[model samples]
Target chain A: MNRLNGTLLRTSLRRRSFSTADNVDGNLQGSKVQIFDRHLKRKQRDRAAWLINRKDSLVNTVADNLLDRLEDVKKTFPTTLCLGGSLEAIRRSVRGRGAIQKLIMMDSSYDMVKLCKDAEKDLASDNIETSFMVGDEEYLPIQASSVDLVISCLGLHWTNDLPGAMIQSRLALKPDGLFLAAIFGGETLKELRIACTIAHMEREGGVSPRISPLAQVRDAGNLLTRAGFTLPGVDVDEYQVRYNSALELIEHLRAMGETNALVNRIKFLKKDTALATAAVYESMFAAEDGTIPATFQVIYMTGWREHESQQKAKRRGSATVSFQDIQKEFGAGETT
Target chain B: MVRANRVVEISKTLSEILVCPLSKQPLRVCEKSNSLISDAIGVSFPIVDGIPCLVPKDGKIIEAEVSRDGDSANTKRRYHQDGTGGS
Candidate 1:
């Protein structure tokens, strides 16, 4: 048994080394950058304040959609893990569903976890078991193949190692367990991205990364497959939120804890450049009402760990009927 | 008494399941050291305000803290300073 355990550990370490190599190569190509600070205390501080004043409509919408999908599954997920700080939203949605027996709430920032715990206090009851942990999504601290379901909303986009995080999520789940997540996709903040780029180039002769590079909706399915998930499904939900001006949009982003935290981000935006960006934003994207539209394209994904009970594709040569026979039966004719 | 028992139960469950991020080996929660020790990796991760500071960037700080004041002594000092009985 000891020898077997040693071998298993060695195999796991070897697999991790390969993923680490891919991560390094991705960084060099600028396709995957370590932009967000791994230590998310700054983000937590901003987000806590935001949650207190206003409702997180975007995340709440995503949470509602996730719950709707979970309802269709028609199975009680006895052990559920809620990733990120949107515990209250999830807890409310999952309540009375009788789906979760034990729920583990985890977040990268300690402050976010504290906020979740505080929120839990008001809703405490003896029916369902719940706990909180400060843990990063990329490097989840949970044991492998122990969880029944893992859900993350509006958080996976900030990860530097998104594919690694997905792989870790899969590893944390038991066979046939579900992984559901929503992230801001490539079209998010399109107007702001353009304005910021032009403003920086005109003023500083160069542009720094002001917005995070979000995963494209087209690539979500591929990412899930690459992470060893089966029956991967990816879809998009677009929302157009109108702001009085670009400045308000920027303020909204800050409150959402979505401000630029890239390591290579400019320390400060020049006063002149900031004004220019706002001007450009208004000129290009403003509506007749003097409000500018910010596009938020949310990409939702669902994947399940491979299990024998799940459907499988037929063997290549196992079909009873041939394609040529079907065509002949339909009286196929070639015409130009 | 019930609350105290619940706290102990939670701590025990956490210690049983938590493992070293690097080595993936089970971590021993040394109540005397106030840290989680990974015997395979020979590294200790400090617990701050009851939350484990397990991020790799904080490893150096944990090492320094452990070496500066021996584990048991530091734990004792903290318990006395905070005026809270040891866990």
Candidate 2:
């Protein structure tokens, strides 16, 4: 019995190390070592029916919001580079807009590029010329300062070098060119994370990594600044998606190619542990309507390249009015 | 086969804009061999199913003798003479 206990303890400790290593590093950001397998991602994307079913709803919603923002811009963009090729909804939104001349859809996954190419045939029109290419976000093949606009939706979060990719994007844009993107934020899948950790600890006496680290809302603004963008804006929007059970949510995630892809992730989970995790998730986050609620936090960011025509900040200490004078003038006025 | 043709068709425009991921030098398409040759690095990236495999590991480096400056001119002439290029 003692020997068995010792073995179990060693196994548990080994499992715990995988999840705790990132905390030891004191940062959740990915380093030079790639955590995601681009080949696996491509294979997953090859299942056309699965991608269409799992991603259509969320992609459509996000695309609509992005389109509304694009419509607000006064200037027209002639050439646009889209990072992710799974952009059917965005294609539809940009269609019939005479302002856009060329749309270059790029993705690291071959299947994704192929899918977009097939879809491009249907979108063929005189207004916008569309093309697809298989290209990595980190090593963009675009020429410097060539594109008028750059847009990415639900794609950049998978990149190991997010900051580098952003810098490449900034360099790809023309002067004063616009950059807009949306990615999953830190708060995404919080309920599932909690449930999985608790279930793993209870079942195996320790926990392993089950979710990828996501960027925080605060990190978005800082990243844009580091990437040399002007007038950067970052905001978060929370989406609550209800599912029949926790297992159903997992299925949707798998179909969307959002499964755990951490390089240090445990290769497999025991059947009992998985079932226990589902039970815990349902018990913890289920609503009165007998469905579990999963939160998806989307972070939206927008920035522009430096241009002579754009507005500039006033010089420091340039204000003529003193604070004391304003206070004195307002202090005598009575409150209504 | 159709997908491969589509990729080649797209490459006509893309080859002009894309560069070597490592050397950042302009890429030249070898139509006979269906590869993108980077003279700076002497690495040829294969065009698989119409999509150019620009990933570093997928590229083939030319032999040392062919890559050397002394024999590069002769190697280029030989490469153009024979249709086969990459390993």
lDDT of 2 by residue, A37-149 (tens): 65555555555324566245776788777756777788788888888634556777775442788788777766666666676667656667676666677777677888888
- Give the share of true interchain contacts found in each model: 0.23, 0.32
Off by over 4 Å in 2: A1-33, A47-50, A124-126, A315-336, B1-8, B11-13, B68-87
Q: After TM-score superposition, what is the CA distance of residue A216 in candidate 2 from its true location, in Å?
A: 0.8
Every model's DockQ:
0.27, 0.38
The models' CA-based lDDT, in order, is 0.72, 0.74
Interface RMSD of 2: 2.0
Worst 10 residues of 2 chain A by lDDT: A1-10
Interface RMSD of each: 2.2, 2.0
What TM-scores do the predictions have?
0.78, 0.80
lDDT of 1 by residue, B47-80 (tens): 6556665555444334544546567777777787
